[model samples]
Target chain A: MSDSLNFSYTVDGENFASAGQASVQVKKELRQLGIAPETIRRVSIAMYEGEINMVIHAGGGVAQVNVDDSGIEIVLKDEGPGIANIEQAMQEGFSTAPDNVRSLGFGAGMGLPNMKRYTDEMHIDSTVGVGTTITMKVNY
Target chain B: MTINDIKNYLDAEVLCGEEFLEKEVFSACGSDMMSDVLAYVKDQAVLLTGLMNTQVIRTAEMMDMICVVFIRNKKPNEEIIELARESGIAVLTSSKRMYEACGILYSSGLCGKAE
Candidate 1:
């Protein structure tokens, strides 16, 4: 909140139409901040995937982004049926989303993997029935 | 190829961004799954998908894509067109199926990741 630029948004669960609103806002802000195209692209894609995941799985959550001199950090928190197996879930093509979500052009089991791939650092913390918190960072 | 060329190639209809026909795109891909597109796409300027939804435009926005071609002559609703318009992306609809559409674009020199 001080020198570091911070932005936050509340993601609505199962709201497919508005899922990427936060990511879009972040992209615009990053562009206005004059962040490099490559960095902005990575951050936006990763953040968008996380936002979609929040809607599909956790029913909605919170997204927070912090931009500093070193890099950018994205934190996503959702209170849903948490990932039962982090190891299996990390594997590409493994998804817990229902078929209805797949019909909407997502739930390909690539969201988490794609998020990890686009970020320099990623961590996932989850519980059986509580929720999940994912932290991702991309260094400048 | 430019968005104009795609219109001529597939005999497609421009649903939005008709004024931006001269836009140039280097690569393209066709998929209904937005996740797959987001996961594997890199520098692909055109998205050929049958999926008609706001997320289609949102995905293109995230990827910085210039055009979205709806395969099989699938028409997007007014809201979808508005999203594409606001996102500054050209939207087109082609009668060609996904396989044929991709093939036509590929043979016309719009290479995918294989290139």
Candidate 2:
């Protein structure tokens, strides 16, 4: 258990029901790896928020996690309509998500902030109409 | 309150995790918004949400929540139930609306204790 491990999943952009599957898997795997509950929780929460963002905004995307003794890193890449304003999106309660996404209890504009809150580091790169990539880390 | 007390208080049906009924929960929060629950919830062992989806189970899991009480008699699908079962989160349904259910539990001394 001295080496790093990597896990990847393709987020089903169209299906909101299946959104958190990858984060759940990561949580289980981290637990089995004997990661502390608090660390596992932080990583899982951040990743879950990112996963939901992928489904709601980007039309599905790639989620990759790398775990090691030092920390865990999560990378989410999406090709949906890219974020036009990252600053605006980071503010709590500022949402551009449509009515349907709001009904399901997301798009409250807490996604990015929640991700940032739970992680040690977070970075976002986006090109409107191209895609968005979010990288977050939770250190062990 | 122990999950059993919540069950008794709400007259809710147990959807799963009957084995966990005796477990105690310190605080509870009711919200249909999963993200709001995630952002605002802390050390709340029970989640009362009407939103029926796998994300509900996942949100509970993320918060390390022990129980989910679906208000307004909203029943989760089989997948959500299975997910909750797997996550070791107890599931229950209450006919009472969100306000009434939370009110009952709050009056019974369950506050979403600040962390």
True contacts kept of 1: 0.88
Cα-based RMSD of the predictions, in order? 1.6, 1.5
What value of lDDT does candidate 1 attain over all alpha carbons? 0.91
- Native-to-model Cα distance after best TM-score fit, residue A117 in candidate 2, in Å: 0.9
Provide the DockQ value for model 1.
0.91
Q: For model 1, how does the per-residue alpha-carbon lDDT over B42-83 read when each residue is reduced to its tens digit?
A: 674899998988999999999989999999989999989988
- lDDT tens string, model 2, A1-140? 57989999999998998889898899999899889998888998999999998988887899999987789999999998998989998999898888899888898888999999989999999999999999998887
Q: Where is the poorest 10-residue window by lDDT in model 2 chain A?
A: A102-111
Sorted into a CAPRI-style docking class, model 1 comes out as: high
lDDT of each: 0.91, 0.90
Per-residue error (Å), model 1, residue B105: 0.7
